[model samples]
Target: MRFSSRVNAGAMNPIAAQAAAAKAAGHPLGQLNDSNPTHHGLAPQFLPEAYTADPRGPLGARQAIADFINASRGRGVDSANAPAAPAVDPSNLYVLSSTSEAYAWLAMLLCNPGEAILMPKPGYPLIESICNLTATRAIPYQQFFDGSWALDLASIENALREGNGSVKAIAVINPNNPTGAYTKLGERQRLVELAKRYDAAIIADEVFYDFTLEPFDGNARWAGEQGVLTFSLDGFSKMLAAPHAKVGWIEVSGPAEDVAQAERHLDMISDDFLPMSNLIADCIPAMLQEAATQTERVAARVRGNMAELHRLLDADKQSGDGVVDVLRSEGGWNVLLRFPSSIDENALGLRLAHDFHMNCQPGYYFDMQSNGFLSISLLPEPTQFERNVQIILEAVHRELA
Candidate 1:
């Protein structure tokens, strides 16, 4: 894969290289120039007395994460219902502050100025902003919906062809936001082939992988993929249902040579940023201990709310010939509600917020192809969620009438 000039230009300074070698050799050297308060024993008792900087984050934290991920994926071996995937190696992981930071680092690692990364349209809206901030071109590839969403492989090939070696990576949001469609195995295989042919890497965002609603059989996590240079992203934000927890990671796997080179450059980038703090890193194990229970708790909330949404909407359709329809959601915290095209989405959004006193995101916020689609969150309390769907159904009925 073609890495950016910025990453190529980065190399360890002689002093740092020697220090690293010395540390690896178990010959600890006193740092006379160390300025960190923790290193000088001036920090509070809660903080570590010594500041040990590990570019890939502290080892203990990474181990806890790896163990958690492996256990999560190892359940129900060879089963279509659960992860049933391979184990993760802690050495292959990079613990960062958030997935947003991971995207920026990957963009910097892959694309130079004017070079591109192909993103899914009707996808995560923040990706374009991240690309723009990193000076990388955000190229869009189509994901069409018939009854369920599927990638337009031809569009992806077209983008790669047009890029002509300028495209460095393809971003796959597994069980994509709003759409809630997991990338099928066939789609994954084709994507790997495309990445190989185009000399690009795959950035798989599996943040929402655990909350399966109506997913197909044999759905799996992308973390252990070995076909191409793949970086699978997941974090506490979604896993533990705690957005305040500032912990996310990238699990790098693929061909041996590609993986090594990517990790070396990523290590350099991580060392420069030192994104994860020791205090937060220390809390990871405890947080991960809560992960399983928390995920199940949040899963129940989203799944129950989704059922409520369907119940209310289905009943309304039976009675009033409702125009609003809930799209088939396989996974994720959000679902798409389709209304008649005659009712403008912007006006509906206004009516819901202004008159009905309820807030919901218009589908265009996620770059939906047409009007009259609203992105509804499935995370609300059951009663409140039912009421919100009721208001939406009434508003759409009035609009259709």
Candidate 2:
């Protein structure tokens, strides 16, 4: 895959190369220029004795992530119907503070000024915000819904045609935030072909892949995709439901030459910022050990709440003051509640917040094309979620009345 000109194209310097060789030889050469207080016999109890600066992040942490991902991939798949997931390599992974940071790094790695990245409409605003911060254009491609959300391939194709090689990447959110729709197998194949044809990379955010609600058959992850260059992102925040964990990573895969070049540029970009902290890197192994249990715990919460929502909506349907539909959700913690179109989403959002003392995000917040849609999280405790649904139904009913 072609990278942006902003990336550092220079080769490794002599000093760093020598240091790498020395380290590989297992010779712990004392650094005359070592500036770390811990290495100099200060704060020995609080800090690591020495810093091992691997620009892709600490080797042990990356390996732990790789193992966890490889194991997790097969756990959810039915091997009888699908091919085995390709093995993940620690060298191909880059640990960062969050998926948001990974997005920024990718934006820099792929886009030059005035170049573009295609983003899904009715998607999270974070992608567009990152584009604006990096001076990259965010071209919107449609994700329309009939019974389920599907990508508008024509829209994406047109954007690539219009970009004329100026498009650097195509960003896809698996099981998209509010929509909760996973990219199907056929869709994935077409997307790979599109990226290959346009000479663009694919940036897939699969943080919500594990929380399957009502996914279609043959749904799968974008990581380890070999058809074209792809960067797959996931993090502890979503996997463990611990936002404070503040850990995320990107796994790069594609044609060998493209992967190598992308990694070289990414290493320089990561070294420039040195974003991952040694302290957090040290905790990754322990954190990963707890990931599967936490994932199951959180998955149960979301699935239960989704069922509660359906029960409440079904039981309350006879009231007839207004109708609210829970749009088909395949995966992810949130779902779109489509209310009566006569009520504007903005006004309803305000009413829920100001008068009802309920905080909610309106559909417009995600750039949904129409009104009267509210995005609701399925993460609350069961009784509280039931109560919240009742309140929402009452509010909509009152507005319609």
Candidate 2 per-residue lDDT, tens place, 1-401, comes to: 67888987776699878887888899856789988676666754676446666789989899999989878776334488666657899999999999999999999999999899999999999999999999898999999999999999999999999999999899999989989999988889999999999999999999999999988888888998889999999999999899999999999999999999999999989989984767889999999999999999999999999988888888777664438889999999999999988998777777778768998888999999988799988998888888888888878876776
Q: What lDDT is obtained when candidate 2 is compared to the true structure?
A: 0.89
TM-scores for all predictions: 0.94, 0.94
lDDT of 1 by residue, 7-49 (tens): 7546679998899899999997888987877766698877744
The true-structure Cα RMSD of candidate 1 reads 2.3
- The parts of candidate 1 lying over 4 Å away from their true place are 8-21, 28-32, 75-85
The per-residue C-alpha lDDT of model 1 at residue 113 equals 93
Q: What's the C-alpha lDDT at position 306 in model 1? A: 85
